[model samples]
Target: MDTVYSVVGLGKLGASMAAAIASRGFRVIGVDINRRAVEAVNAGQAPVQETGLEELIAANQKRLRATLDHHEAVLNSDVTFVVVPTPSDERGAFSLQYAAWAFRKIGYALKEKKGYHLVVLTSTVLPGSTRYGLLPILEKESGKRCGVDFGLCYSPEFIALGSVIRDFLNPDFTLIGEYDEKSGSLLESTYARILENNAPCYRMSFENAELAKIAVNTFVTMKITFANMLADLCERIPGGNIDAVTQALGADQRIGPKYLKGSLGYGGPCFPRDNIALSFFARAVDTAAELAETTDRINRALPAKIVEQLKPFFHKGATVAVLGLAYKPFSHVVEESQGIYLAKTLADIGFRVVGYDPLAAEPARIELRDQAVVLDSLEECLNQAEVVIIATPDPVFRRLTLADLQDRNVETVVDCWRILEKELKGHSIRYITIGQNINDEESQARLIKLWGNTDANSDT
Candidate 1:
């Protein structure tokens, strides 16, 4: 493609996109305020760590380059993609402090360019942010009209951190919130050229696109919460299995199998916060997002509830090993992780807790501090524990053999994902999960009394 692409921000997502776009035979320029990140990219190395990012950047160095000068990137490239941080505020709204600063830099660059430049905002924001929040800054700074001299589009990337390159290249659909027809069409064609797969694009106004981006994450959180709710119900029902219930529920076309599995609550950088931000937005519009509010409450309460469930399994002084400290497998991010909350609560309640993850050990250490020891070795964590919690559905933890726990003093195992059910069935260790009934006398007696023949007794 003749059009040069420039990505502002050299973070994981931005660096990955610059590399991916260059791989598709486009000359790409990356702009970042960090001098170290800029130097890293220009030296044929990845500015940040991600799956296959270093290799991809190294391979595409001839086509891709990075700079600290926004003017250099914008003046040289036809399209500039802004992917700066939109961190959550105290009230759950996305703070556009970083985005506004980045846009002002691009605005100065746009002032010098004579040709039409399409500036795309890929940062997550609420409705009216692009039109009402950012567009005015660009217009005032550049001293030019948007539709006439420059173009704008609010097109956020729907991608997970670990698999950003692949997800960006092959999305279910692309959403384009356009300032005008000219800008949106340019972006649509650019995506068509960049994407290996011919993904369909959904075009709309700026506000619609902004709302849609947050809505997708919020809706998925609700689905995850619903599945988690069923898991709690399964624990009380006779012969109840959450897996079976969700499987049947998923068979209906109205509900798909994705995110329907009953496990720990959803967490990461995005899902939990999106629900809160949407609720905040709803309140700003003078309405109540009761469902979202409830979902957030239930997810936040899971760690405490889980600790209560394990009260009978171990005493105060016993050591507990929490496997998989990251929010998900193949990722190092521990932001809003359920495993973090679980480990902290267990340690707070007087249990000595040690946690392990394949990628997130160092960051987990910083997050947990003295509350729980973050171990670098899974073997060490497994070896020094009386109880083990399979906190995430990591493949490494799933492949754990009975021999791995042989020399350990572990008396009980709580498998959140139920991956060890078959392996631990007849073992000497006590195996318990969230979804299935354990044939406990207390639960059975409680059910019997609740469903007793009250009418027959009253007649007598």
Candidate 2:
């Protein structure tokens, strides 16, 4: 029989895993320190708004449950998946405190349990995380030999927050790096039921798995940086559209399109932090990655790029509304989000910045604080601003029509996602978007359609 699965941190990744495992017909326990998070899950609700997640939870509510007690979660489940946060400190150091605390909690709990238990780590950690960071602590806590008494692996999960549930249920591949054959076999058996396509499960030593996760993100970061570099050049050259260039480049079989869209740089919790953490880890071992540093430098300049984009319309005391503060569409997480940083830069440069997001208003308010004004409605945001920039292309926001913008009294629409340009071409409102050619006439037409159409409603 498959063992009961417990997810220790009911955040985005953990909640999705808990729900996915339950959907796969396994007994799943969702555990978190946050009371609200636990209650939401226990009530058959998702803590975050993910596509198809509520339905999945509703379908498998009987198999999945949430709790605050860590000991109960550990003792009840045979295999425990740890998906806790390991965010960096103020000084940009990867804080190991959270991971260590979770490890100790799990280790101590395992000591009180009778049967065989396997701990799977889905959190991203620096290389040697399993051997140097977690192994000794687990051994010390449990007072047991590593392979003989229990099983463990640093099986880092590859999931984007916006699409985590979908990615968890249907990943391109699965990497399970175990410290021992027992851990590998145990995790493999558990994954067999979930990974229905029998996705390639590469099993190796713990260090390799840790490095693989870093490599995956690092490569993606580099790809985005490359695209952004092209975008910078495209901005300077007449009739140079970075979107066109990327599309043409993606036509080649070698560079099949993915993560090529050039925007305000890569954001979210993982890419920036993981890239830097990987660099730190490498530097600690006297092997600094120059390419990694370059990638970091390129991404760090994206906020400044937004400032430059606004320089053309830098009227004295101009107020700009930044729509969509989340790193991506369909997610509320704004850790190291480019939109927030862009708003901060604009605000610092004497441009009054107002921010609005469908789901990330609270998080953006907290992250940006007094630096930016977070408005309630998109119309209120658009009405108070001179230039409105759409940073995230949330499907909800993407479907917005010219009538919506007109009703909202929007003046200038800057689309970072390259949407709404074609739809609002006849409008008199100025339309500026990323990687697109925008002449004054086009901008005026956009403005007319958006702001000048006072009497016309829903009539293009």
Candidate 3:
């Protein structure tokens, strides 16, 4: 714990990492090019929005500080973690533009410092990015041999935006892509002392670790898409329930039941892009990645497809309310959200859309502009709607009762996650769930005809 840590790029992940590290009895220096971020962190406040981030930063004030100078941070710390953005390019590959710049600055700082310092890249990137794209920049700017003078590592954090601090302190495992044995050992030991969970460490070469990081994300998305595909199939079958099917699938030892909700398509800043990036990476090295490509295609088309299916339920120019506009529950981020996509698609089809989220109303309003009305309160959104679509499985929507929904003016409710099935099933309002049959008798007759059954009592 005596070794000071410096976290570069004070965005959501970086800022949370700095605060979380400091909370565990280590001095942390936060580095960012943004003056506001630096000033905010230095004043014991969080620069970006995240769950419990402001309070965590405020609590760890004594051990944490921020600086704009990379030289100051690197010279004073034993290990510097670079968490700059590697945004997706037009080719769907993670662009190393920001990461390269950060490495160059850290490399320059290494030239002036005399001891062994470990530089860890905690940003997500494609395979060979750390070794090929970023490693040379570090060696060139420092004018030094990598393992001999200093050590380097590519150690991306597997975390989501909302629960970053909690996820960081208690990760299932830590990945270390080492320049040499010395570097990996240092990072592993650092995790041992700092992490609250005492997680296992996976150590390997830079390329393998980089590929593994992206592979984990892409694979999870594939699993999620498979569940969604089943959801689509379930809608056609008589009395098919996605929850029952997924529960059985989850009991299987291989599947293990996470991200198998089978309601909405996977969407977020990371999930939507990682699959495309992995597909792009696979094709670059003479490999076919149809699963990833297909997953991306299916997930992208899900919003519009759902909208089209609900077209019959919607009346022309009917006021519609979309509850939960954020990507997932308990976060303000609207980037690549299915809720936002649903709002736009619904509005484009002539529905007067009003959207609401506990935290994401402002950003959703900005993204939606004139397409939908982003309301200040959920009550206001519900009060103005003739029809409602539950886009996210937020807990507030889950708590809605039959009386809360049945004003006699609201005609229909489409529950995407079946959150209101028990409360509104036998009510005056027409209730529909996304992954279940609306007309069971009609579906049974269609299935009977397909099997050439002449009698209604005959079994296929």
Model 2, residue 301: what's the lDDT? Answer: 82
Model 3, residue pairs in steric clash? none
After superposition, candidate 2 runs with Cα above 4 Å error: 47-49, 90-93, 401-411, 425-427, 437-460
- Model 3, poorest ten-residue lDDT window? 451-460
Least lDDT summed over 10 consecutive residues: which range in candidate 2? Answer: 436-445
Candidate 3: list runs displaced more than 4 Å.
453-460
Any residue pairs clashing in model 1, and if so which? none
For residues 1-460, what per-residue lDDT tens digits would candidate 3 score against the true structure? 3899999999999999999999999999999999999999988888999999999999999999999999999999999999999999999999999999999999999999888999999999998998889999999999988899889999999998789999999999999999999999999999999999979999999999998998899899999889998988888889988888999999999888998988888877899999889989989999978999999999999999999999988889999999989999999989989999999999998889999999999999899999999999878888999998999888999998888877536789989989888888988989988788787887788788787555768586
- Give the per-residue lDDT of model 1 (tens digit) for 117-152: 999999999999999999999999899999999999
**Each prediction's Cα RMSD?**
1.7, 8.9, 2.1
Off by over 4 Å in 1: 454-460
- C-alpha local distance difference test of each model: 0.92, 0.83, 0.92
What TM-score, over all chains together, does every model reach?
0.97, 0.88, 0.97
Evaluation by lDDT, superior candidate among 1 and 2:
1
